[model samples]
Target: MPLKSIRVLDLTRLLPGPYCTMLLADFGAEVIKVEDPMMGDYARAYEPKTDEKSAFFHSLNRNKKSICLNLKSHEEKQYFLRLVEEADIVVESFRPGVMEKLGLDYQILRDINPGLIYCSITGFGQTGPYKDKPGHDINYISYAGLLNLMGERDGKPVVPAAQIADIGGGALPAAIGILLALIERGKSGRGQFVDISMLDGVLSWLQILLPGYLTNHIEPERGKQTLSGGLACYEVYQTKDDRWLSVGALEPKFWSNFCKTIGKEEFIPKLGEPIDQQDVMKYEIQKVIRRKTLKDWLEAFADKDACVSPVHTLHEVIASPQVSARQMLQNIPQQTNSLQQPGIPIKLSETPGKIRSQAPEHGEHTKQILSQFGVKEK
Candidate 1:
C-alpha cells in the first residue's frame, strides 16, 4: 500500500472529514479517529441502527481505529498532544475557534511536530466574513449561486440528491490538499496548514458559470439554460411507465440523430433556439417519449447513435452490468461477524484499496492508540 506507514489523527465527525479520512484509510494509511467520550460522532445516533450502529456511520468510517477522549480534560489533552507529536496529519472540522479553545490549534500542533499537516474543514473558511456564521451543505450551495441554477424554470430551487458541497467541495479538495502538502513536505521537510472552505469549493465547481456571467453580464436563472434544463437536447423525459430517461444529445450530430430517431426531424432546425421555442420542441419530444415504455425506448435506441440512457435508482445502480464488471461494489464483512459492507471506490492495479475492517465501536481502540503515543494505557 502507498500510504502504509502514514499516520492520520482524525478529529472530525459526520460526513466531510470522516469521508476524507476514509479515502486515506482505503489506501492503507493508519487512521486514528478521535471522538468525544460520551456521544462520539452524532451520526452514530442516526436512525435504522442495526446492533447499535448506524449504516451511515458504518459506511463512511471503515478501516480506521477509534479513540474516545474528553478534550476538555487536562489529562486527555496531554495525551492528545503526545499523539500529535508522532502523527503525519491532523484533520478537524470544527467551527474556527473550537480547537483553539481546546488548545489544539495548528500553531500548537506544529510546536509539537513541525512536519504535521493540519487540515481544517469548515462551512465558509478560516478568515472570511462568513467564517463564524453557522452553515451547512445547503447553505454553502445557496451562497455560492449553485442553487439558483437548479430546478424548474419558474419553480423553487430543488436540492440535489448528492452532497455536492460536502463531498466534492469539501472532502475531495481537502484530501487533495493533504496529499499535495505531503508531497511538498518531502522536499522542504515542513508541514503547513490546509484551510478548506465548503463555500470556496462549491464556487470553484461553478467556475464555468462564473466566467459566462462575467463575460456576458447575464445572470443565469433556474432551468433557463442548456446545461440547467432549458434545452431539448439535454434533459430528462418521463416514459409511459413513469420511469425517466436522460437524453443528452448535446452534440450537433447526436441531436440530429436523436430527432430523427423520435420522428421529430422537422424540429431539428430549432435545436438551439430561444428558450420559448426550445420549450415547444421539448414538449413535443416529451409527448413522443411518453408514448413508449422505458424498456421499449431502451430497445428502440439500443443500436442508434442517440445519447440516451435510463436514470437508475440506487438498487439498479448497484446491480448494473457495468458496475459489476468494474468491481465497483464489494461486500465487506461486519467487524463482529461475517456480514459485508460496501467496497472501496478507486481501483489501483498494483496497490488497490480494500475494506479491511468495519467502523470501530466508540473508543474501541482508545487504550491501544494512547499506548502507541507512550501514554499509560487505561
Candidate 2:
C-alpha cells in the first residue's frame, strides 16, 4: 500500500509498458490503462484465447483498469489532459515523435502538472542514427551485441526464447527509473522524462564483457568465451536420455571439486588450460555425464561440491521444488469466473504488489473514467 493513492496513466499496449505498469499496479498504484477506442491493446488479440480474451493479455495486464479513448479526437485529448492533472505517472511506449505529434509529450503534460513522471520506452532511443528504425526485441538484442554472443561456436546465432531486451532491459529498467525519479521528486518537487531504450539496457547488462573487451583488448566471440560456452567448467551437455545438464563450476575450487567427483581427477590440473586442452578435459567429463541418466546424475550431485544442475523444461520449471519453496508463482483469479493467472515475482515485507482485478475488457472503464472528468457518457 505504499503507492495507495498514486495514479499511473498507462498508454503502453504490448509487453514492455504493460509489464512495467503491472509492477506498479502490484504495489497498490491505481493504474489506468488507456487503450485505443477501436482496436484496444493489440495484445488483446494474442493467441490461446479462453473466451475472446487472450491469456497473454490477462497475465500481463492484471490489477489495472482499462479506459478506451480516441486520442486523435480533440474532446478526448482535452479529457486526457484533465486526467494528467491528477496523475502521478504517465507511461507510453511509442516511437520518439509519435506522442509529441499527438501533443501528449512530456513538455505539454508538465505544463499542466509539473510533477508528472513521463516515461518513454523505445527501441534505440530518442536521439541516434538508428532511433527511427523499426525494431522488435530480437533486433534490439542484435544491435546491443547480446545476440552476437549467443549460440554454439560454429552454429548460427541463436535468439533466446525469452525477450530479454524487451522485458529485462526495457520494462524493468524503466520501472526502476520511474521509481527513482519519483523518489527524487520528493525533494525537487518536480518530475522528469525517462527514456528507456532496449538496446541501451542490453548493453548495460554486458557490463563485465564490455569492460574486458575495452581494457584487455579481448574480442569475445559466441560460444568461445568463458562465460559463454567455451570453458569446460561452464557449459551444457546432453545426457543419455536427451536431457541436458548445466555445469557452472566456474570457480577454481568448484572446478577442482567437479573434476574430482566425475572420476576425472587428473583433469583438475588442466582446468585453467587453453581451449584445446580444456576440450580434452571436457570430452572426458561429457562422457562421464552421458553415461548416466539425467535423474541419476541429478541425484549424484544433489548435495555434492559440483555446481551441476539439470536443465529443466518449462513444464518441469513450473513444478520445480525450488519454485514452490520460494513461493514465486501465484494463481490469479479471473474476473470472468475462469482459471487463475500467474502471480507477481518480487516479495516485499511492506507494500507488496497484488492483483486487485483481472485485465479489463477493451475500454471496460472508459465510461467511468470519462465521468470522472465531468464528461457525459455517450
TM-score for predicted model 1 compared with the true structure = 0.97
Runs of candidate 1 with Cα error greater than 4 angstroms are: 335-342
TM-score to native of every candidate shown: 0.97, 0.96
True-structure RMSD, every candidate: 1.4, 1.4
lDDT of 1 by residue, 301-346 (tens): 9988889999999889988899888777767676465534567778
- Give the poorly placed runs of model 2, Cα more than 4 Å off: 335-340
Candidate 1, after superposition: displacement of residue 344 in Å? 2.7
What value of lDDT does candidate 1 attain over all alpha carbons?
0.90
| lDDT, residue 360, candidate 1 | 92
